[model samples]
Target: MPRIFTAIEIPADVAQTLTFLRGGLPGARWIDPENYHITLRFIGDVDVHVAHDVASMLDSVNRAPFDLRLDGVASFGGRKPRSVFANVAPSQALTDLQAEHERMMQRVGLEPEGRKYTPHVTLARLRDSSSRQVADYLSERGSFRSAPFRVERFVLYSSRASTGGGPYIVEEAYPLAAIPAKRAI
Candidate 1:
């Protein structure tokens, strides 16, 4: 089984900017900058056949490339502080692309994602970090922002079953265009 998801890779410059926020927070297992990505859809654990179907289905997603910015920082577990992430500035293009992925996955017989989409890139996995610790971390870096970057493509990624903030492998790649190319232009 492969734990799969579809995501847009963060550019190297942006990842370098994100690296500055890595240390200081207690119990924070910071994710490597190389693994930084804005997940479009999480397919979760699936068997080989379903994974193959997911890859084939995703190739049909036809959405244009668009700009994205990372703005602000936040914690997921409100009080308990399970993880920390950089919030993705919401854009209609990102939302539509994500929804299209959702629709495609369902068409391939995968379960719909239950959580409402809140676009973000996980920066760290929080374990024993306290509420005060989390709050303090957020406060210091709350206004963090990155230069906007173009999302020219999205990828099918695989990761081991573990507390995420990954070691992700790009299983396949798919390009984006202003419109789906019709029979090779």
Candidate 2:
């Protein structure tokens, strides 16, 4: 059984920018640039039948393509930081898309996601790094930002069941609705 999830693939140029934030902090296992993505929903290992249900259900999602921007850098877990990430600037379109995924998963018999959704791209996983170390790192590089990137589609990705930061395979992709061109008066 493959561990599956839905996410937006980071463009190469954006990923390259994120790579600059690597190193500097000890005990940080930096994620490979190619693996960078903004996860929409995390669906843990499920049976082949359930996976099929998920794939088919995702096809029904109708949303327009939207632009996303990386605004800053932040860390999760507060006092005992677990991972560092590039914060995604808040967008209602992104939130609505994610909410739809959550609802769809629950309709497929998966339980509700307990944590509130906070969209971000994981940069590194901290192992034994202290609070001071993480704070100092954030203090230096927390102002990181990236130019807005157009999100044309979302994908269903599969990964080996292990510690997160992926070697993800895109099993399928669902394109969002394209914006219509204005007609001449």
Candidate 3:
């Protein structure tokens, strides 16, 4: 059984910027560029049957593609700084999409994680780090932001079992609709 989740991938240009942000802070273990993603929902280790069920449920999902702006920087975990993240410019569309995903997963009998959905792309994980350095790091990048990127699809990924986070494998995918045709043909 592989730990799995659904997420939207950031484009290469945006990912290039996130990749550059890696390795700057002391005591931070930066995520590999490939692992940077905005997770919609996490469905932990599950049997093959569950994976297929989740995929089937996801296929019934309906949502238009949306633009997401990467705005601001933030950190999680007090004192020790467990994670560094790129925050999204709040969007109602993103919220609705996530909520739909949660509901769909729940209807499939999956145990939903009891946490509010906070939209973010995790950049790094900190260990053995003091708040002082973490605070400074946040202050330094507080104004940092990235241009909006189109979120055209979401995927069901199976995460490799590891203490360091993941080596996610795409198990299924649902592509969102293209932007409406301007002055339809």
Candidate 4:
């Protein structure tokens, strides 16, 4: 069985910006810069045959590439925060691509994802960090923003079934259609 998911790769420069925000919050297990990615769908543990089926279906997903940005910082768990993340600024193109993946997964007989689709690149896993600490951290870096990066492709990744955060392996990649450049007179 393999734990699979779909995601967009983060450009190294943007991941570098995220890396600078890593420290200062105690009890926070920071994620590696190389592992940063915006998840499209998490398709838990599945049989090898099913994984192959998913890869085939994903290869059929047809959507144009779109620009994406990391705009702000936020934490999960309202009271006792469990983790902190870099928000993926909203884009309808991104949403539509994700929705298409959801529909494709259902066609293959997988259970529908239970969580509402909130796109974010998780920054750190919080263990014993306090509300005060979380609030202060959010306050300090609330205005975090990155240069918009073009998402030319999305990938299917596999990881060992373990406590969240990864060591994700890119099992397959699906490229999006590129926009044509305007010809100058």
- In candidate 4, stretches whose alpha carbon ends up further than 4 angstroms from where it belongs are 178-185
Clash tally, candidates in order = 0, 0, 0, 0
User: Any residue pairs clashing in model 2, and if so which?
Assistant: none
Query: What is candidate 2's lDDT per residue for 61-84, written digit by digit as tens?
Result: 888999999999999988888999
lDDT tens digits by residue: candidate 4, 1-185: 99999999999999999998999898899999989999999898999999999999998777788999999999999889999999999899999999999998999999899999999999999999999999999999989999999999999999997776789999999999854666999
What lDDT would each prediction earn against the true structure?
0.91, 0.94, 0.84, 0.93
For model 2, the superposed segments whose C-alpha errors exceed 4 Å read: 178-185
Give model 1's TM-score versus the native structure: 0.94
lDDT of 3 by residue, 1-185 (tens): 86889998888899898876776688888888787789999888888888889888888776788899988888888766888899989999889889988988888798776998899999888887788887888888877789888888999888788876467778888998744555956
Give candidate 4's total backbone clashes: 0
Runs off by more than 4 Å, candidate 3: 178-185
Estimate TM-scores for all models: 0.94, 0.95, 0.92, 0.94
lDDT of 1: 0.91
- CA displacement after TM-score superposition, residue 148 of candidate 1 (Å): 0.4
Reference-based lDDT, residue 167, model 4: 93
In terms of lDDT, which candidate is stronger, 3 or 4? 4
Better model by lDDT: candidate 1 vs candidate 3: 1
